[model samples]
Target: MSSILAHNLHLEFDFSYTSFPLVSLSIAFGVWLVWKTWKLITISRASLPLPPGPVPLPIIGNLHQMSVTDQSSTFLQWQEIFGDLVYVNIFGTPTLILNSYEDAKELLGVRSQIYSDRPRLSVAGELVGWNRSLVLGKFGERHRTMRRLLARSIGGKHAQSFRLHEEFAICTFLLNLLEKPRDLKLLLSQLTGSVVLDVAYGHQVKSGHDQLIFWFRRIVQDFYDATAVGSIIVDMIPALTYLHSYIPFTSFKKTVATWRAHLTETIEHPFSRVKEQLRNGIARTSYVAQHLSEGPLDFETEDALKYSSFNLYAGGMETLAVALSTFFFVVTKYPAIQQRAQQEIDNVTEGKRLPTSNDRERLPFVEAVMLEVLRWSPITPTSLPHRLEVEDIYKGYRIPQGAVVYSHPWAMSRDKRSYTSPHEFRPDRFLETPKEPDPRLFAFGFGRRICPGKHIADDTLFLAIALTLATCNVTKRVNEAGDLIEPIPQYTMGVVAHMAEFDFEITSRSDDAIQMLTAAHTQLGE
Candidate 1:
């Protein structure tokens, strides 16, 4: 039967070379087609106005070229290779990494409006409705309102009103660290959380293990981690979202829905509670209550409540935590810096009080330490993504619209053009007369999206560090093997950066230290 089938198939074919020539020609044409495509790509490359970069392959582009080493270091290395302004293709999307301070200033500063937009985080911002979050919103009316409200609530002059809370929060943090030295990270996170929560929702978290605080932070961390990670199959190849539910693997729809539901619940439940509390003749001066009463403004909508809460969670908490972590790591490593700051505090307040916002100007070292802490750890190295709203013509080249602009603080902070010893931790850099560290402003970010919580962050850090350093000395904890183990100064990756945890032992300082800190703490409240 098989032989009969082969015989019949052969009978259908003509064995003449004249007829076979057509098939040969077809094969040759296919090879010629591929060759022509290759040539076209090589020639087209010259015509395209490409930014400075290594050549990229078809489809994926330079996505695979990105190395996920320590994000800052990897970016620095890329800058060295591709020049200050490098273009890398991120899944066919053009990404601009500005390694120079001038380039960042030019793009994000001079071309402010054109480069101030954000990439569409459809899943987190749209799906979870995080557009209401201040940091995620597109540049427009809503963004202006959100930023203005935040600045009013937690920015400059308004932060002064919260000095009492800052004093209490720092004192609480110092006392906890002195008593239970092992739980440093937990205590620091909660201290910041308590202040922001009180500021936003009028809720006071007494401990790091508070259920509400724990759940809120957990959800926030999950959301941020998800936001940072790229799900290219769905993002680059978006049709996967419409896959049939009958298929066993439909996790994308479920995961996104579940996250959005979680966010909605987390954000809305607290607003209701605050409202209920307000109705009982217990009016609290929180951002949430203020917004609720004010109702809709030009920028305020019902969705604003949830997004504002998200901003409170993201902007308010992490900056404080990372700053404290940087302080701890620096103090543990450079005991001299800590001692110098302590001496300055002692001289100003006579070791009888902790430093306050009022004393921030007097204690130059305290201010310096805060600056150095931000510079040393340098959180959010890449800052946040900025999108080009219009084509930017700079340096005789055109930066086309739709480019993803990265304002790399990592590179900027370490630029030789900025600091003398950019890598080393030097508090004195801030004290120099002719030129102090040009404000170390990169840590917070730039333009309209610049962190509104910066003033609060500064106050919180100074008070916390001053109180902690004045009262107790941070040294390495002894391991079970009797060797002192210090925190390895490594960074965690993401849009935000943090010091990796290491066990350190905090010992109570002399009686004078405690007395001075207490006095300073008292002065802070006044």
Candidate 2:
């Protein structure tokens, strides 16, 4: 009883005489609790309210309203209802959609350091092992270094060095198209994939059945399966990633294990081939060969080589094919666009010789058409998400740290403030004075995360569009009843949008065009 009395007296003395007291447990604990509460209150006052968005449901947030297939279109509708910065929460995960160029530019561009990081992709990265590649990997020294290496190889003018290979592929594509004009998708895939593979591993793809093409298709399908929005439970709730294996008697773990194995095979096979060719002193000049040739390689350097090579090929090939396919859709749907482009090409080439890389500057209208295609329908309508690194406030709206942010190129393309008649398909918009923002600026990406392979992809696309328009006429196919089968853009929108179901007729412009292709085939020794 005397000890208890003494303890109470000490607590009373501490509480009365000192703001900080180590002598009394109860008083010290109370002081610390008060300090923590004050800190939290201070932080709360500093941050403004979140950006406006549709009212979210409790606990589940906006998950019920999310669309798996048409996320961009849905976000676009929300942009109309809400403001440019639309905030959402999915199962406690915060998401912000920047529906205008200015918002995207201000946040994702001007403040790149705060917004450059990619969201953690639980299924695709952790389970399927794509985190080894830069696309799904975290941003850091490794990502920047790998991007530097890619920039050295193919970023800008270095892309011009691959013209011989590109021209060879284009010639083969044209020759095959002449024989089988209906094989649009097959021929275009071969063209884009072949160029990317050549640059990646020095593996030339001359046919549709090339082993690399099969590997490409496998990896692409696997990637889509792993990353399809609302498909993987762990991706939706990343905390569940740790518990995935313990989720009882399901083949989920085995499925992911198989996907992991396939990804390993796809990434390693070409790397092994390049090493073998180097050992025999017969290696071709390619990304892998060039990097391996420089004396010894540390583990980090070699790992960068392997994954960055895949990043280059995977990042570039699929989208180029889609963009090329969109070109066909655009020209077929609007013949006048094709005529203007063809006439421009004819004036440059004098209607005889094929347009080369040297003719790009002279073919302004062709470049405009290419720009318009990118703006008209961005393949990846909404960019891959960017994550905020720290809490920030913009325009009186607080953007929480770890919020997944997306810049909407689709909505930006249709902004009335930026483009006159935003819904119209006008290539001349690119040629006009005080030209609208170059879609290339936002199309490939923005800030530091922009595609390093943009130059090479642009070169290939310009050549293909110029050559195809110069040599052939794209028109709607006639049915068996001789009725014109008018084609509309039947887009099956997803992660990567495609006009996969459209049919159009491609035909040789004249006898001269056929002979030109024939001579090129002879030069190709095919």
Question: Candidate 2 residues 1-526, lDDT tens each?
Answer: 9999999999998787885454587777889999999999668746568889988999989988988788887898899899799999987889999988888888888999989898878878888888878887788887887898888888788898887677778878887876787888888889988888888888888677998878877888888888875435667766665564667633466777888888898899999999999999988778788888887888997898899998777788778988999898889889999998899888888977888889989988899999998888887888888889988888988888899999988898888888888777899998999888788877888776788888888899888888889888889888899998887776778767887657778889999987886786567443
lDDT of 1 by residue, 44-93 (tens): 55455757876788998877777553556667877888778887787778
TM accuracy, model 1: 0.85
Model 1's lDDT to the true fold?
A: 0.74
Candidate 2: stretches off by over 4 Å: 1-47, 238-246, 521-526
What lDDT does the true structure give each of the candidates?
A: 0.74, 0.84
**Top candidate, metric TM-score:** 2
Look at candidate 1 and tell me the lDDT of residue 199. 76
**Which candidate should be chosen as best, given lDDT against the real structure?**
2
The per-candidate count of clashes, in order, stands at 11, 0
